[model samples]
Target: MRSNRFAVMRGTALATGLLIALAGCGGDSDDKGGDSGGQTLKGVTIEVAAVWTGAEGAGFKKVLDAFSKKTGATTRLTPTGDNTATFLQTKIQGGAPPDVAMLPQQGVIAEFAKKGWIKELGPEVQAAAKQNFSKVWQDFGTADGKMYGLYFKAGNKSLVWYRTKAFQDAGVQPPADWAGFVKTVQTLSDAGSTPLAIAGGDGWTLTDWFENVYASQAGVEKYRQLSKHEIKWTDPSVKQALKTLAEIWSKPNYMAGGAAGANSLLMDKAVTDVFGSEPKAAMLSGADVVSANISETKSKVGTDALTFPFPKTGAKPPLVGAGDAAVMLKDNKGSQEFMKFLATPEAAAAWAKAGGYISPNKALDLSNYPDDVQRASAKAVIDAGDDFLFDMSDLYPAAFGGTKGAGEWKRLQDFLKNPSSVDATAAGLESDATKALKS
Candidate 1:
């Protein structure tokens, strides 16, 4: 049976005066949805922009399809791929922003709002948001006292996935604190197994690792400052966190193929390879979505596999994650209708039923998920509520976060390749942030 074997979850709410006002505005929505004021929305084709591709894209389309069926309106999805900031600027400056953009960050949504390029949620959308989501979930979309985005999909990136039998055989239990975690790593390594499977080659994965550790190690206020470039990366807290990360990185045999081998492993190859039989690694620190991903790579979700929280490495366990948010740019009936639909329990249920989708909306019944494992991950995020932080790198400027070859991704990847270079890495990150956020 799977427990929290290494993961149980619960959450608290973080709300603002504006969101507090929103909280009292409505109640939870029904799973099937409410009236769409259909006459105004019928036959109007709304354009939506998002970064989803492959199965993710396909699953989201089903939700859009459900909206079409409900409101008698057509929806077209425009794939933004990885360049959200540039693509958005190009569209907005050209006077042709999509009716809606499924922004990847609250910070990005705020940026759009600041430039007068997006619309605040209309009354219906705002009311639906209050009815369907938690206050903290709503806060992710709020900036400057206005709600400009509606979170639809989310993931909790704080779990450690392990080869069940390996852990059992090695006499290792999922760890709850840093000391136990290190001991567990040593146990796995001493027992002739690679202790950790790191997705180092994929720069973005490296950033996730840094963010999780930093948030826990350095605290949220510093996390906020570093993310916004309000504080220098060379601060003592940043180095202290790096030292903590170095403990794991410095251990040669703890990871598959030593440091060099781990550095060569790409994100796509990391989990599947690690979870493969005759496994190279006994554990993986990954997001909630990895539950499904491990299965795709032939690892059983709750049997061959199990998970635990990634231990309390600092003041507390911090939930670091990412999500997709719906923001209206056109202010038209179709756009308003679409945003309203996204904030419903029914909209969430549609995607959850389609598989590989998790709604932050508290109104969605856990029964809609694929299985208990999926349910637990969803509940974990819901329970963590207000204490969680968005994926740090994703919450900042492009040059500092999501761009392919630069920013946190590249710098951290470089640091991992040589753990002794933390000082250099910290300096480089600080320099990049200084340049990127110089409005």
Candidate 2:
């Protein structure tokens, strides 16, 4: 069996380093040791591939710099552009794959592991994960009873972003449960504000909405069964979640422009409609990237802009989140050492200090984060402990999870347009999921 080690932690939002930058991993000269923990890792060169770009890429390099110095190693950084899976596959086929790769999806990891293309993490890395991370994260790299990945960096999806001024003006408290959530939207709607900003034009946004609600309402096992196609989409649990979605979606006045204006809003526009001037929508729910959008607006985050966890509506409202998991393709002394470093709080601390990053490693000090928004995102995971689940679309076959027409994207889009036919929507979803997973 092919072995792989997965490591995922939180860092800069939407970091896709489209191009590579050659730079020395920065640090004081004295700390660059020839041997770490009595392991002589002198003069070893490790190759790394990732999609992290912009601030995210820079932050990761800071961590790499630390790893480089600690073990007297150098790294060749390769940016995977938009698709790490495709990039890694091409390299492997050519017998020139990098020593390690930061894979963005569990589905890709599973596929690679099945093809005997990945190497399992070293014992030291696994030990750190057992002690530092929650089980949900530990499982990110594990398949069929063997550990393969480390979920190092995570992004919270359960967060509900809102204009602080709007909530206060309407005398509405951030909701704690699903009932309160619906009621708050009604209150905001009555206050002459768009209660929700939904981006229907972009199909993936619709999938995100459905995943969050479905995971929260249907609970983890059902979510797992559905994600893997073990349970049909037409199951009652899924239907119940769909019906629950309509509770707010069907109420025309509750959405921006009464649902008629959903498609044109787009993701960025949908956010600006809420956080921008004279705000159109009062609330929105999405991953931490929402903060990046908040930064673009004049609203001061944690003040004019704020967030709270998605309301609990199931047996365990595990925080719905997403992250990139680092995995090994080549098992060697150098790559193993780097993986161990990544598993340390000290390593994540470097990225955290760079801002726009969060660490699921409980060993990481929350005070290390630069702002309240990041701390809040990290805290939700800490608060949920081992109860969180990855983004559903990320864990599924692309055919069902992707934005192609007639996939989960279109199904959710259709449901949003005519939410009353949730049964039809659910049936269509099951049919597609079955075909996709089987194929």
Candidate 3:
């Protein structure tokens, strides 16, 4: 399975720019009459659900607005909080699932498909996916040999966003390796600035931190094994990653609010600490979507704020990628049409132009991105191709990956608060993961 995914990535990377020219250009078809097989659905209303709120939500609304104009369909975005899976389950059980949902994890797609809740996409959507997306993306949406979803939004999590002024003040360039990263942190602190802004209040952010470090230090094969539970969390590789993380996380002086405040600081505020007036920190590590959080601040993206790939722990830095897949919960013309639209470059372009968005659609023109920062982030994913790994937590079941105050989320949060017990953290992770994956 891993080899097949990698093969597709390599092919996709090789064909990036060339595919756009060959993908015949008519994504907007406006024939208003019924039975004309046109995109005109004047009275149809499509309800979509996703975990995106704030800037991300507002950006997606632009895409829906574009779709509405092209198809005449009324669209509503029902913002599901961080626990989207739980919210979705409640709606499904109530016999009122949204027409479509943008699920954050591939495991959720498999879970829903196994429960017979998600519908297999029709041929049109499937074909559009084939034409625009790489086989790796298609595989992410497939279950038991059938495609059930389409990945529309992609994020590169191996980025560290830093203030340009902080770098200048500290006389430091972005670090190229783990050792240099550590020195950079200390240097920034000595220069009278907090070195990092950690969104410890949100467990998933910590998970991303662990993933980048683990993937780079342990190598991709071991990373894949651990992700599948083929290797226990107590393995030596896991221990090493935890200790590596502790190098910075264990130091309170390196973070805004000295760890305690960060434990309660949500992502937006953490970002603001770095970019807002009277900046408190020099850097924030997160997915490419962190740009959306940065957008909410007075920071000008390309000039005042910029990103460097996560520093290398091994021979090369790991590019940890993630995405949201659109799945159909109710089979109808309107839902199918919307899903098909999402598969097109035009749809991806709509959101890309709105800023703070990335698409894994190989056929998408990179020129659609608003700035060099956005384009560089998108290119890093495309260029990494077969070498990329999706967010590790998202690859696991919700019990282990998505819940709050329980499972991996809680266990990692505990690890953050007390970096003293690597063994206990590993044992706890393995214990919960074993039980969750088994059932």
Candidate 4:
């Protein structure tokens, strides 16, 4: 079971927004009108809160319904809006927190454990997890020597989504190394296609690139060390990673419209530009972003495009996508049984079928997926071993995460405008990171 300290703190931060939104959504009215007589599953009801909204929320409902049908448990889902961290905090504090919460951000799982709000799932949940999931899933949710959450499904970001036809038209092979990758980009650019579709406007997207490059250049352990502030950003490996990003952004016809204007392109639009028949661009680096975009645009996955792992220097591990885990907050027979259900192969399969993601439970087969790319992505997640986790932004403090969103992306854009600013830019980031850590 994960600890709940972080959830508690996050709840406090999100309390005001949650109250206003809940109040506006007639949540207060529901509280008054609905049976508050403590409805039980069988005779008890379990509340589950998630950040997913719209289609995502609907997809989750399918899985929850399946769980309910099998276990005779009643689940009430509350769409906490876009600010999940805040919404989770609010729900947990009001004495009406969900029994099982789907935490989108994996980095804060440990922090939540440190707080008392979350409870560690004891022997029963662990036994079920051991039977259902791969070792990687178990390792990811284990913190401070205790298991806090059950890994549900994951996506891989170390992928470059490209149009198959576009690559063939340019007469290029998928990049196998950093040099080859750059050459492929140059070839694509020379052929009149934007080499990379960079989305600078959404700051978090930029952070994904940083993590990809960092992991590729220095491997996952070093990347983890960098995140914990154990290694200086001025370290050669760190500088090399940043330089790689700068080079990619600086290339002619590489990033769409150079650095200054690249910020105008959102991730989805950038991806669409690459895969569309008109072929405005050649490739985009992102995780399940392409899948989500294609689903939204009603485009086909394998027919529209495919993805490959980012080329790197060293022995490359499997690329990882973002994933969510179910953390137990209030421990009781009901919560324990619910968590055990979550760690089952049935639950894993249900989640994969509904969400179109790879279940962290290795015992479940992925042959049912329609898209070859998604199946390949699932293989990558399975192969990533214990190194799997989400992007760096979610791993760092909110302030630092925001800085990466706007500050670092902006710095890269500025450097693209003037390559000579590389040293200065790197220095500035290192300084800022140092300060952020100190504070």
Q: What does each candidate score in C-alpha RMSD? A: 8.7, 4.6, 7.9, 6.7
Which pairs in model 1 have colliding backbones?
4-7, 4-8, 6-308, 10-383, 10-384, 11-383, 11-384, 12-386
lDDT of 1 by residue, 1-439 (tens): 0000011110112112322232222212222333655444554778887765444555676787678767666667775646677787899889899999887766677778888988999988888888777888788899899999899888777777888888988998888878789888988888887788887756676777777788888888888888776788999888888888888988878887777877777644566666775577888777776654565567787788888876877878878777878888898878887887888888888878756667899889999987777788889888877876788776676667767678777888788888888789899988887776774
Q: What local distance difference test score does each model get? A: 0.74, 0.74, 0.81, 0.64
Worst 10 residues of 1 by lDDT: 1-10
lDDT of 2 by residue, 340-395 (tens): 88899988998887765667899999998868887878888777776777777777
Supply the global lDDT for candidate 1: 0.74
Maximum-TM-score candidate: 3
Best by lDDT: 3
Which residue ranges in model 2 land beyond 4 Å of their true spot? 1-45, 69-77, 81-83, 251-253, 256-261, 264-269, 314-318, 402-406
Q: Give candidate 3 misplaced runs (Cα > 4 Å).
A: 1-39
Each candidate structure's TM-score, on Cα atoms with residue i matched to residue i, is 0.86, 0.83, 0.91, 0.81
Ranking by lDDT: 3, 2, 1, 4
Q: List, residue by residue over 1-439, the lDDT tens digit for candidate 4.
A: 0111111111232344543343223121112211312222454566776654433444456566655555555667665544455566677688777777876655557667876667898798898888877676777687798899887756677778887777888899788887888889889878876788776655556666777778877987888787777887677886777678766776645877666667666655675677664557778877753564555543467875777787775677436456678887778766786787677666666655653456667776877554677777777777666767555655544334433233445555455566556577777667766665555
Candidate 3 lDDT by residue in tens digits, 1-439: 0100110111222233423322222223353532335457776778887766556655777777777777877777775656778888999999999999988887888989999899999999999988887777888899989999899988888999999999999999999999999999999999998999998777777888899999999999999899889999999999999999999889988889987876776676777889998788999987777676677679989999999999989877998877889999999998998998898888899989878788998889999999999999998887777677887888888888767777887888888888878999999999999988887
Which residue runs does candidate 4 get wrong by more than 4 Å? 1-40, 81-83, 93-96, 276-279, 315-318, 387-390, 402-421, 424-439
lDDT of 1 at 166: 86
Worst-scoring 10-residue span by lDDT in model 2: 1-10
Give me candidate 3's TM-score against the actual structure.
0.91
Q: Worst lDDT window (10 residues) for model 4?
A: 1-10
